[model samples]
Target: MEKVQVSPSRTGSHDQSHNAKWGIAAGFSASLVGIGLARFAYTPLLPAIIDAGWFDASKAAYLGAANLAGYLLGALTGRVMAQRSSTAFTLRAMMLLASVAFFACAFPVSYLWFFVWRLLSGISGGALMVLAAPAVLAYVPPSKRGLSGGIIFMGVGVGIAASGTLVPLLLQQGLKQTWLGLGIISLVFTAIAWKGWPKQDAAPVHAVQHPRQSNNTTLKALYAEYALNAAGWVPHMIFLVAFIAHGLGQGLEVGAQYWVLFGIGATLGPLLAGVLADRVGFGLALRLSFILEGVCVCIPALGLGTPWLMASSVVVGAFVTGTVPLVLGRVQELLVHHPAQQNAAWRTATVGFALFQAVAAYGFSYLFSYSGGNYALLFLLGTGAIALALLIDIVASRSVDEAAPR
Candidate 1:
């Protein structure tokens, strides 16, 4: 037999390709554990926690707001943590923290204990959301980045779907056991993703080389739009399950089933939105998403029946997650030549989203208590916010076009 030699370039390409696949897997796991399990699992669990007498409705709602508050902090600090330590180290640590938070939540030792753990879970989720995709995408070939990014973010939808399906079954085992089950699942994901991160983190941005100045007007509008979108989605994110379970007099199981539908929509949202953006342009896709989401979000407020509610769950779920890629794509379009500026714009958008989400959570929680659990009011308000965002985009797009050299 003749010996065959492989060239260095070919071998290096093979290794890079191998590592990129694992990196995408790690990114997916990070999102599944961080955002899916840490943040969304709590939505289904909210009504259960209240029903179990672990906390009164108002208190439990406020506890949900605590996670949003922590998310804001984590979004602001995630990059700093990566810079100080390393992206991989920070991602793994955050996943472990989220898993630990789930276990700690199982006890419900006190309101303070549960609040602290939930907040920690939110922190983990926010950090993972910030760091995971960029770390993985840095290694992926440019041609595949779009699809890879969609696959990674689909973890959130998967996590949401899992909560809708698995949480109900786990609840039957007992609430304590449900928490344990979630923790076990998160831990397994953590272990699986441990070695999947890229051997090298994405190269740090050097601001000195890449000046951050670019279309300021467009960037400001984007930040505002992203923040408003975050605010508008809070009702469904934190209260949909409770509203159905308690507000509509539907049982927990029925509410969980609706959540499953939402999860299914969420799982498909990003991919669908990406394809739409490719066809119609991100700006148009974004505006259309706003219109669809606003209508869906208002269905419950209109006192609609099961079919409408089902449509609401699925459409709102899809738009809620779908809007993400649209917004990111828009940012890329706005700052096409300025990579550093694009990153800065995205960080600003993310921070604005976290800030508005935290504010809306607390504001809505207070409103919910004040209105005597008026779920419809919250839905209307959410719809109003989305409408405002659409209005802003309409105005901003026109202005950007007029300012362009024809």
Candidate 2:
């Protein structure tokens, strides 16, 4: 089906000067497979992988880090790849790679095999993040960028929700089937989105004649804040269910239920953030998201009952998942003149976030070891990182008005 822009025509019909809606859907499906299924789905699958006797706990953790390491490499590599290839090609290729990776995981292979597939999946996902959004938003009017981008970003949350909701049921069947199921889902979405991308005939979607010096201070600050978000968001995505079920004396079933709520919040977040960004500026929307996420990060520590814990789950889910598109909107606006830099900047932000989260995931173990199971300290550390991100955004806002043109 052809996606139409929301504008009316001068001839008493719709005027789609651009296929704005299709672009958004293309970006959305790319993101859904990339971050949503490729990255976030790992957390939900961890237990199943362990139960399937693929790796010990230590090796499993290491394998998880391998995925992040690949994400870092992919982010850097994707920037260069985007300059050389069409978004339609790269997007379709990555989807195929991701589908292959998930299909490979279904086998009871050696640890190295699993590692390689996981790494490939991460690379595919990271590249899409770098390439897909800009392709979709390139033709969208500035006024619609936020909501359109948000819709695309909502794919991540949708993927998350699918993993949280579907994985558990898949686990009941077996790990092999779960892996196959995920691969099929990726393929289905990829097929649906394949035609949504517009063909590029003039220049590559991310072409650059020369490397130019970047002068956008707000862009840099946004990148830094984007990095910091990894500290707060990843832990909850990976560990919130554990802390809720075990740390708070709830059972694994209870934790699983809460995770679904988190996924639900994530699923809805991008749309909400998109609307919010449209109403308020991207900067304000981003700042508020970070602030609210900080509060949510600390919410688990108050020993709140199920009600409060559930609320925290939703808010944390929404904010953590929501911030990506919101930040991407700002990145787009800043580099609107230099479309090539938009891909580079997005890749740079992902690299920072990927590397930080990879290191933080490992580092949190030491904090966990030293505290003798005081998971609260780990949560505190996460809160501190978010607080610092919030501070940076606030300080940057005061010193440099984001309203200035690059």
Candidate 3:
């Protein structure tokens, strides 16, 4: 079969092109605000929050897990919301609520209040991810989806990079000021992006249906692989800074700087992943991502030099976060004829991702305590999980190949 490329002329509409551009920008900012300010900021602030007598070590870790749990809930709830409302409404609402959560934490609240705010912020990140990126892609031309997804997914890295750098610097001003600063930054952006969501004036909200197991084996394989990938990321996302700062005896400043390196990988990851997936097919790209991520996680575990650890950060960041949109892109391929099923698959994938992260967060925190803050061991375990996911992909592939001959 010969493939016909989709050109700009084939894409149709000067207005839709403009809208798609803005839609991507909105997703980028939404990602920046939702994940960068709301989620990643917590990492740089975690040590400070504990040092200030706000919470003990155990509670601090639990807080991280709680935020992840909220994100899981957001995914489940976002699915329900998608059936009832436009993506624009869901995206805007989540972003606004996330900003409010950030702002509320600026007050000298009780522990419960802080937890509530963190959870709300996490909820915003997950819901925005489910709604915002898909909305933008829906407006894009078919040929451009991969690159566009890569562009939009850069938000995770942007957020991570910004928080990794900004939060540590802000901590010099004290925790209260840091919280206020994060809140203000997120709120301002959400305000600007308030009405910017592109209106898909053509499609009705009810066009998409609930997910079906039309391809049960493929769905199961994707879910297992994705869930494992989610767990693989939690160690770094929640504890990498702490490991570098406290475990390595480098202090928070140095940790924050290296985190910026990790963010750099994250920033570059999706763009490469998307383009590569488009060229080579998503299955191979996914395998490559999982393999590299496994290697990246092991660099620090090797007790190598500082530069090696830093290099690993970038690699891990890129592969871990970058792999997301590629997987979603793969889901798009699997359901090319079933557009509604494709959308439902994306939502379900997010839920699976979040559910694993929430569980991994608490478990990793406990492992951190149980092993006496053995950061190296935790990273090693993450490496093993990545390997397992890779193996699952391999098994699924072989099974599919064997079935084809029958």
Which consecutive 10 residues in model 3 have the weakest lDDT in total? 201-210
Q: Which stretches of candidate 3 lie above 4 Å from their native place?
A: 1-12, 82-85, 200-212
Clash list (residue pairs), candidate 2: 28-152
Q: How accurate is candidate 2 locally (lDDT)?
A: 0.77
Off by over 4 Å in 2: 1-20, 201-211, 214-216, 245-252, 332-343, 365-374, 401-406
Steric clash count of candidate 2: 1
Q: For candidate 3, lDDT tens digit of each residue in 205-308?
A: 34545456476576678888998988987878888888887878788888888889988898999888877887899889999889988888878778889878
Tens-place lDDT digits, model 2, residues 79-115: 5775588668888898889888889989857889988
C-alpha lDDT of residue 94 in model 2: 87
Best by lDDT: 1
Cα RMSD to native, each candidate? 2.0, 5.3, 5.5
Q: Report the C-alpha displacement of residue 302, candidate 3, in angstroms.
A: 2.1
For candidate 3, the per-residue lDDT at 169 reads: 77
For all candidates in order, the CA lDDT equals 0.90, 0.77, 0.81
Model 1 TM? 0.97
